[model samples]
Target: MSEYKATYLVVGGGIAGVTCVESLAILHPEESLIILTASSLIKNVSNVSFYAKTIVKFDVHDTEATSLHKIHPNLNIVYDSLKHLDTTNKVAVTESGIQINYNLVCICTGGIPRLISDSRKCKRILGIRDTESVQEFQEKLKNGRKMVIVGNGGIASEIVHATRGIQKIWVIRDDYISATFVDPGAAEFLQDTLKSNIEKNDSPVLRRHIFSEEDTLVSLNKNLKSAALGPDWYRKLENTRNETGEQELEIIYKVEVESVIEREDTEFPLDVKLSNGKTVQCDFVISATGVEPAVSFTWDIEPKFGKDGGLAVNELQQTSIKDVFAAGDVACASWEHAPHWFQLRLWTQARQMGSMAAKAMHSKITNEEVLQDFCFELFTHCTNLFGYRVVLLGKYNGQGLDQNYEILLRMTRGHEYIKFVLKDGRLQGAILIGETDLEEMCENLILDQIDLTLFGDDILNPDIDIDDYFD
Candidate 1:
């Protein structure tokens, strides 16, 4: 057993943990900062660009954990899994029997893939989350003739678009695809693009860089899970295909996977029973249902958890436990949220929360007043779906708003789709699909709360030049 001490400790090597430690190193270079992570690889965010006040675009790189030490001499990276957190004593014990004493600690362990109920019973059921699991899925896909994907989230969508020359059976409980992010109209618009991509058999040409010895070492520990893969993780994977150049996709809507039964005679080897009384025979099933917070370590005093099974946190990212905080997917914002802002477990929120938590922690230590981050005032996200850039601002899907709210839409079929949610003639939310380039304008409108009752539906008119009109 060994003992170490730090002024600040952060757990997990994902975006949130890295961001927190990096921010701390920048803010307090004289203080000792330690990051203990289960994974040897850390997610590094670079080339960051803000599309709006809160909307951001950046590149995520899975680099060696030691690379951070090189950048911040005050930051120490420890490769170990958290076994216990003695919050009362301000100490953390690792699975390897190493103990860390800290003045303050932040948990950004992220989340684990929410597997199907019967996932443990069958080896054919795979849940894609970390690097190792994705590699396992890729290996299985090489010989897989058919696959059943069970989810309607971003992960499922990415898998559907990335794989080629294989028959894909997409099973979803929702009527429309990508229900988690977009509305029905946007979902409908994306259908053509999804089909076109499948027909074209477009495959990602980029390949992941070779893994280092440290990365391989972390993967060997099956019990210790790494951080969730980044947004563009699918691009780095090999585009597996079958012997024939035929790629087919079948979407089973409004159904759930009831059970998975092992087949004795069929070549597929597994039979998937659906809630809609349909059975699918496929080589494997990908469970992209979602994720649960990765809070496996025990604590002296258990922290409050939200309905989503994440550590409940206040506006300052502080958990109920004293001197303890949480960020990223493992954290649930229990405080009253801004009207247009809500929490979503994405890399964007993880980075924002991590950076905010660092400032909050610094304030707590220095007894300095700190305000909540401006990023929390509005909800913004930038992602790509079906090869089209998708930007979501505010209540993009009109979430939480009553039926009194109105919607204005302007769609160009296969080219672009724009939707605006209005309440009392003010821009409450907006969704911009394709290369609309209206993100900044729409975001400003939502934030400014400028009334446009007089403009009416002409707000979306292409010839009107709303940007100039607003100016």
Candidate 2:
């Protein structure tokens, strides 16, 4: 590749990286920018967000209480790989071995699929690594096919639900899925709901609760959350403890991907392997893998660690490197309110981090005379599950809720409403699995950041006036 130069260097081309460049161009249009990716820009993975999801719905609105629907927008992406970097002279080289100079650099190389093992036996899934691969995989699903997506996180389950009318599917979870987010009963609530639906449909389906390498990570420390004092039920549940629950009970081995392969009698087939030593034969395979911050540029600049040699920054998004800014998935987040400082990695956090970093970068322009917190606001998220639209805000640890909290249960005429709130009244987090209108109420409650302390603590009693908050 021919050598190029830029005043600002933005690596990777995912949502975070793209947002980073857009922010920079908005802030420093006069500065030359370099966005380097290793492959075709358009084909690189991007995030498939429930937040960005669109749908068609007729609207009758004058002004207030307007209806919102899907609005599709054309997106453009570009990519070129980086091969070298010289932090001292602030010059970098690309994979094509082309050299370029920069004034400021932002490393957002995104993440690689953190598959526990590199075995080709298991069907590779798109967790958080790439968005394009997932879109392609979804396209393959639209072409009429069956697939077995392994893993139990929100991503896998979301994919399972999205492909519902289209693809015949089986989702295997060693233990409970998303045990981290929902409580045991809640996870069980979800597991039972999905499993029963899958069984009722009689689509070729299987769920395993036997064992997994992920279970081994049950004790490992998360970057953001620090380990708290007492024991947590979800942790044990995630570890697959002996519990009185009907979990498809299929003891299929992750290594048993070979066994399922023979079951796929289809003439057009996509081979799939699992970490459990099992083999699956499907028309396609998708792993809902994850991504990490890209910090290859920072590695050589200073002291580094296991991966993403990123310099630590406070909440303001300031890095160890002066005037050098970082944001989104690229910024290493510290735990704020809890037993531990768990690493914060999510879409909302990334975007918030990016925007905050942009603000800080601008602050450098005359800048602040006083020493600020050097902080970036962390994020929380809301999502949809099949017919159920779920919203999770703030940090949700595996531990059960404190006694001061109340579970608001409401069945209005027929709509079921269940909302959880902290004793202090802030909306720690909420889930809306049913009652579509309740999501609106919940979103409003969260958005307004109201205090429920004045109201009765018995939210599950279903008599509280939620309209007041919205009003």
Candidate 3:
């Protein structure tokens, strides 16, 4: 096996790994950095701008790993799959027999979609994670009339919203939709858009390539799992309804999958038995059942792991094993997180953690005191659901605040929905749907912790400009 040396090394070419290597390159231009990724395409964060303190906007580009040479000269992208990592000696071995010894290493392997059933065992069920999975789904969806979706996260939510003219039966374990992001009220508001009778012809969905695709999927060893799809992966694809009939969408709430039986007797290929005592016979099944971190590389040196199975890292993003660090979905923060900042495996957090981990490593190398990033002060996310703009800040849905919080909500049927969570007259969280233009204001409110007891119910009044009132 040929051995190489690198000053900084990153594994997994998703947003987290790319961000870490880029930051390292920028921070120490003289040093050489290497990235080992399984996928041919690497996700890079571009057009970055901080709209607010923690609220930032950026576009994710899935570029060919080879083309990354144009972005940074010192940074090198290696198209190889990692087989084992030896944190004891600070060395990593790839499946191709290329060994690398690095002074500092960061694992950004991200996570893989946790399917309801094992992929190898079930040919009829597939989990949406990469372009290839989506392609497979599209081919099956072409002739599919009835489909079953298992899970209620972002991927499942997007899949249900984008697909049309097909009988979609969403199997959710929660009573409300989008249990990961929105509250029951917001779910209800967004659920209306999925109605078959609702006319949504005026707005055309934009389907364009955000990044230059130079390479296709590469054949990796069975040990290496593919990285999770980045942001806008669903929007870029063509989601059109081909079936012509009374299309219906049914929700089977508060149920779990009991078993998946491949039946040759039925017209459909598979029969899915649910916990609710119903058998769903459909063309195929979609498992967006969430993801577990892809951290098998740590098998050589078992680091402290969190409950979610991610490597446990401190506030500085350092793993229990020295010289080895982790970020993105692969790392779980074990430190006392800020009251508002909680862990969610989102693109924004991946970028933040990656950049922060780079800083932490740089500080260790240079023996400099680095302050923690302020982004951790609050939780912020911007996404769209059913053609509606959505912004979530801080403890948006009262998350950990429990019953100690009071909520103020405002709605403008089919146009906008706003909710603000206040605790002891101080702003705790806020959710804005449909271009409310209040993300910045609410972010500041949550950070500043100003008393809002005086405003009372006028806080969410439609006519009241909350920004001006605060000013």
Q: Which stretches of candidate 1 lie above 4 Å from their native place? A: 197-228, 240-246
Top model number, TM-score: 1
lDDT of 3 by residue, 325-382 (tens): 8999888888898988888878888999999999998888899999779998898877
Candidate 1 lDDT by residue in tens digits, 399-468: 6664456778887767788888888788888888988879889988999999999987678877777889
Candidates in order: C-alpha RMSD to true structure: 9.2, 11.3, 8.6
Compute each candidate's TM-score over C-alphas. Answer: 0.92, 0.64, 0.90
Local distance difference test, each candidate: 0.83, 0.44, 0.78
Question: Model 2: per-residue lDDT, tens digit, 138-204?
Answer: 4555554455565445565555544443334444443445533443334444545445444332321
Candidate 3: pairs in clash: none
TM-score of 1: 0.92
TM-score of 3: 0.90
Clashes of 3: 0
